[model samples]
Target: MVSGIPWLTVLWATPTVGAALVILLPAAQRVLAKWFALAVSLAVLAITAVLAVGFDPGGEQFQFVESHRWIPSFGTGYILGVDGIALAIVVLTAVLVPLLIIAGWNDADGQTGLRGRSVQTYLALTLAVEGMVIMSLVSLDILLFYVFFEAMLIPMYFLIGGFGGANRSKAAVKFLLYNLFGGLIMLAAVVGLYVVTAGSDAFDAGTFDFRAIVAAVASGEFVVNPAVMHLLFLGFMFAFAVKAPLWPFHRWLPDAAVEATPASAVLMMAVMDKVGTFGMLRYCLQLFPDSSLYFQPLVVTLAVIGIVYGAILAIGQTDVMRLIAYTSISHFGFIILGIFVMTSQGQSGSTLYMVNHGLSTAALFLIAGFLVSRRGTRLINAYGGVQKVAPVMAGTFLVAGLATLSLPGLAPFISEFLVLIGTFTRFPVLAVFASTALVLSAIYILWMYQRMMTGPVTDGNDRIRDLLPRELVVVAPLIALLLVLGVYPKPALDVINPAVDHTLTTIDQPDPVPRLAEGPTP
Candidate 1:
């Protein structure tokens, strides 16, 4: 019903344009820029909220779609839409940016982060990343998606290199290099797709239309050599895996997360990295169902390894921020595992986990940043008995930590439960192994809290103040969201289940039915 509105364009363009407008603000108008940026983000959030309320989960698979001719001769058009999966994430992107701006209100002005700039640059970059992420999520044209997908790295690189810790430059370089290599591979895959379509009876000429390609793929009209398809699948998967930074490709993350300012790290971990996994769900599986099935085992194995490896290393981290970063690797492992398991519960749970991880991680990382800023250190040993001084911050930190470990009453718990349950139905053995992360996560989170928050005051940790009014503004909503979603995931699941059902229909993966034992003969 919202079809005529071009809402998707406005949703993304609001922030993209807002960033430019923000950049235009004079240096003397720093506070005005901050408020303006926040207002723009909130307006974007308002648009997403309207979309959510108007969205009919029972209706069209891709809602509020907008398509216009753009380079039509090249078989590419400007197109945008959202399935329940994409909408959920779009809303997530919208929700987090405003909070991040509030959390980062002082980052540019502080002694920390990059030197010599008004707050405008930091805020603008944040808005720019938000806009680009939304564009990537909503684009129905693969090449359009690819353009903004890579475009995101530019603003993000500046945020990290300019606004992070002492090693920001090195960390940002590593971050860019790893993702650039991944993008190069994905670009080849995108070109290969156009070539394959062009040569097929499926089209008059090469097309970059994602829906057209998906239709052809699902209908078996888009047949190609198994080897070629496999190569193409790997090409796309390689980029996503690296972006997801699964296991081996993950070396760039901890350093980047630790070096970047806390808010930027949250945006990177919480929002942007999701585009990778999102592509795996939308493109990899649906576009190459056969190849996805072919490589499912290997991918699942790697995901499981990432789960355990990340947890083990998280347990060993000496730096608090680095520990949080490692925990994300572990959480992302679960997300990837769920996606590859190819079960409705698994994919749905994985989708929900992305949102939950954003909320929980934002809370944890931002609160930690507040503490570090006060105490002037990121080392775990440098903090002790923080709870004795700043009880509110400590309490919120514990809640965020528990959510990270997927404790029973928090948001991540339900997602983790669904993912494991989904996996167990098909691959019980792998599920059993992956479950070990639960214990390891508990060890890392609780131990970290025990060491840093619970002991007697030391290392001048007593000087640590409680979360300020502004910090409270950032942490409160996240904690509430974790609680609300944890208890009533049914609302999200309602929107998500239909989409999951549709994806499974496209890829032809039905959930496995459990066999009941025969009743004893009477």
Candidate 2:
């Protein structure tokens, strides 16, 4: 089914082209601009679907790869490819963007105080973000990946600062500064890697091509001093940790999520933050295996702390948006824990969690947004017995919330269970500690649901309307995918396992040997 077509190029270019078209539209053609953006997103989704069908789940190497020398002098190139992991993420990005477009269509119509020009600007920026995110997923060149990675901030900054709530500017600035600081650190690491490569016998100059870098490392031609290597690892780790917003570094997330519009928050949480974990796997482990192994205990300990800390903080939140943000911090901890555990099941589970979290969190955020739009407030106390007025909306919110808590028979449950099982095989104590978050998760989600959707209808809740047709369209696919993946996750796991195995093979690491009880026979 594989075709010779430049699918990756088309996939990356479509949304950017759409953004240009929307921007070129006449000032008065706001509606046309929105529709055009939606059309472009849909097209990208279609292309992604085609990619999935043609993708070989058993393939051990990157597929649909396209490469060209962009900067021969520096050994940088324009490279794009996807393995099962990247393919899954690319599809997730495609699926969410169109739904986001639909969910935010009316909101973007300038009804919420954003004018026509502002609306157009919002849609264009959103499309641009979409394109960059996809580009990041498919890029096989570290330099190209970093370009897409850093470039994404511009449009997203505007998405928040220009189109977000009252303190949008301040939140946007904080988000920018935090990420920029991380990016600068990553830049230093990138330069250090290049220096190591150039000094090696593999080449006279360093190369930014991922394959070349991996080959050079594998041949033992590019060797970094152990001390320098550990520092480089920390440099990359700090950047991704901030981006993943792991615990102590996670301060920026709540503020940004609280201030950004719902759709923007979805993009940030669902797809963008994944880049951090994805980079940890793709770059950290692949390029610096010794450091990754050395740092495993520290990373695992932090992840466990994040799991408990995030869940406890989530239970204490009054702002619904901030609560969801905190929950993501907890969820990300699980993803990271699975990744660092290094078992095939754990790695695949982490990868699957990325997709499942994207779906589940999108539903939660968008459904919450629907409620906020109706009641004109983001406070949980402002809502009461909403089910009495809007049963469907209440039900959708419950389902999304349950998904977040990793309720059994839901998408998240499958991934979460695998992560625990995989981790328990090696680090049973850490697994047990991480499992306590399940109870805390239930308290946070159900408590929030009880406070917001149960009890008597509040004074203003009587006027609250049910989910409109457009709103349902936005959530229906997410819910359906969640259920489908929950029941039949084999398709995703099948695609993911090969890549996970390949990653472990590349790193030349095996699962930790389990300790067993001594027999009484002796």
Candidate 3:
């Protein structure tokens, strides 16, 4: 294997490099701009596919690692890598970007200044955001990871404000302020982590490397006062919680989802939202194992509440997009539950959920965009008997809806089952409450599907057509993946299992010995 040039770097760079090429096109050439963006995204997709194919499932350490010291004195390095967990997400982002580009081809930005010129900006910003998010996911160095984490906000901020629907400006501002506050809090914690590790020659002037921090903490060599560790942990947790957007921190999501363009919403909910849970997995659990163990109960409690609360609100929604957004909130709760349970199965299941959820949710959002573009409304009541006019579109919606509800033999079913089974070992009561969410999900997804695709045809929609060839091109891969992974999940599970073992081992916690039935402890 190449010593320093990690394959994951290539995955991260493919998009950025593609964005640069797209930006070189003349600003006025809208068609060229659109095609070039498509070409670039396609190229990135190819690279990520290679990464996925070449990734070794047997190894326990990060694959395709590229590491070099960038700031020698401060001990910061430009390090990048991905294990099974990171690989899953990196690929998911890759899979969704091209579909998003196609979804935006109609340019539903309402009022337009540059006509299709906005497409160029949208393409470039999306590529940039994808690169940054992948970097954050794979970066082994703490400071480098933080830089990637914060950089993503800039592109998303502009995308929301410039191309979003009515009240976009306000939604954009709220999104920025919420993230900025959480990021500032995280920065302070990083400083605290540095101060605690200062004087170790291993890090020179205290390195901001994530692996280093974990090593120091686990070995008990880098001594931060217990109270100090607790404080720093909370700071990190707050930032991630805001990102995972658990419960009270979730208000920004609905408004943002409602106001942003559908493409932007896909990126935000599918890719960006993963960052929150990613933080908890990459930083919080690794850096503060004790604190994580300490906070398990409370975290699980909140997650359960979110699962129930978000599901209730989703069923009650009249707006289809808003309903989808609430579904995500409930999904996030399940993911959080898996994380805090500290089981290998739970962790791996959450990681897999991150990947599958992105694909399924992107399909739902893009398909929703198609319907709205043709019909000019997102209201559930505004649609009916659309399947007669648009059989293919209705079928795609059914697949996505079933995927969302985690129906048996679907991709989501495997992951959700794993999460509940694994979490139930530790917190049976919480697991039961969370399990009821599956029934709730069926309610909302099928209800929405029925409202839109069943019943007598409406006057205006009678002439509406099925998914165009172009729309099929955008949605086909997502539908196939749901089936492929659902039928044979061993490929993904192989990549995930090794890294999950490493994560559990590194945390130095007891292996989660799952109890199949209630009985005396063995």
Candidate 4:
């Protein structure tokens, strides 16, 4: 049921309005623009907290639901709602953007010859991206979700091309071309889906209403030829896979991550990437259960390949930024594997992993970005013994690194454990292969740490200063979350499990019953 408050519109529109206002601010008020943008992000965060508190996991599948006539000819509406799955990422997006704004405080200060006008543009673009992402998460109309899903690429493209390293333009174009190609394929699939609905006797007209179609699909009311369904599924999967970047399609990520500012990279990897994995759970499995089951083996194979492949490539990277980028690819592999495995634990753990990964990766990547900014380099071999001068920075880096490797007491460990166990119940050999990433992760992380932070203080490295107060503010909450969620993920899990269970029910996949080893009679 829709809430009385129209909270869904307010949740996304706040930042949209803020972005417009920030852009309208006079050029001289750049500092004011920055603070205003940050304020908007924080307000959005507060809104998410209210939604969380008001969200009753067991009450209804969608909360804060709202629908209105939009493009009546197309049978689409301005619809929005959130189940636990969507809410998890909405909250994740909200929590991360404020810190990202803080982390990127000086990233667009016209440092690389930005004519003093780039600051407001940078901040406004970030807010615009935030608003569009939230809209994509809550949207119940498929076309609306697709519009924002594709629209966000605009702000992000500017963020990548307008700021950061020399190769920024090249990376931005590559990122756009790859995703646009995928989106184009999905466009065909989306239209095909509408056409199928129009031809069906179940609807008054063709509609892009996601919930309506999901309901009809579930009741076996909306039927399409199996071959056509598979093609449609492939179209959607291709787009999401490119975004999720499962293996071979992931070449664009490393460049984009390296070229984009640290905060933007984090926003892309930690937040935007979650949406891809999210599409798989929400749309792929729900809308095309038979097709999903049929294609499970192929996807699981690619996921395992990506897991090991990303880790191996990361171990060989000489660039610190590139190394971290590769790690995200590996992490995304685990997320996809969990999703396709279809166990309740797998899906729940995947959801939690999305959130934990955002925190841990953000903490690590931002710290690394801080180091790179000071030294004016991203090469790993460029420095040694950083800990001698920047102990706090190195210490925080260590914790984030350990979390990345899924250290026993860190937040990622529990989620990783659940995913593996869940996958093992269904696909043991694939689980074993995927598990190899644990050792690979430890190697890359520890080796990088030893070279960059632990050895004797090299000549230039001794000049490296510690994290500033603002930087500490950025890292502290992420580290604290990693520790807190590591020790106790119940809060996150509680919100995620019901939603996961419902998805499993929708797909008709049951958790494998445990078969204990027989013991000798005592």
Task: Report how far residue 289 has shifted in candidate 4, in Å.
Answer: 0.5
TM-score to true structure, per model: 0.98, 0.97, 0.95, 0.98
At residue 59, candidate 3 shows an lDDT of 63
Clashing pairs in 2: none
Candidate 1 achieves a global lDDT of 0.93
Error of 2 at 297 (Å): 1.2
Q: Rank the candidates by lDDT, best first.
A: 1, 4, 2, 3
Q: What count of clashes does model 4 give?
A: 0
Off-target runs (Cα >4 Å) in candidate 3 are: 1-6, 108-111, 114-116, 199-204, 514-522
- For model 2, state the Cα shift of residue 421 in Å: 1.8
Give the alpha carbon lDDT tens digit for every residue of 206-318 in model 4. Answer: 99999889888888898889999999999999999998889888989999999999999999999887778998999999989999999999999999999999999999999
Instruction: Point out where model 2 deviates above 4 Å.
Output: 111-116, 513-516
| Candidate lDDT values, in order | 0.93, 0.89, 0.85, 0.92
RMSD of 2: 1.6
How much lDDT does candidate 4 score? 0.92
* Each model's Cα RMSD: 1.5, 1.6, 2.4, 1.6
Task: Please report how far candidate 3 places residue 361 from its true position, in Å.
Answer: 0.9
TM-score sort, best first: 1, 4, 2, 3
| Predicted candidate 3 versus true structure: per-residue lDDT over 1-522, tens digit per residue | 444445777777878887777666676766787788777777778888887887888864877777787997877899877888888887788888888888787673333675545767777888888888888888898888887788898899988988887899999999989988989999999888877778554455677878777887788776656688788889988888887789878988988888888988999999988988988987889899888888889999999999999999999999999999999999898888888888887988898888788878888888998898789888889999999999999999999999999998789888889899888888889999998898999999999999899999987898787899889998999999999988898988898888888888878866556446778978
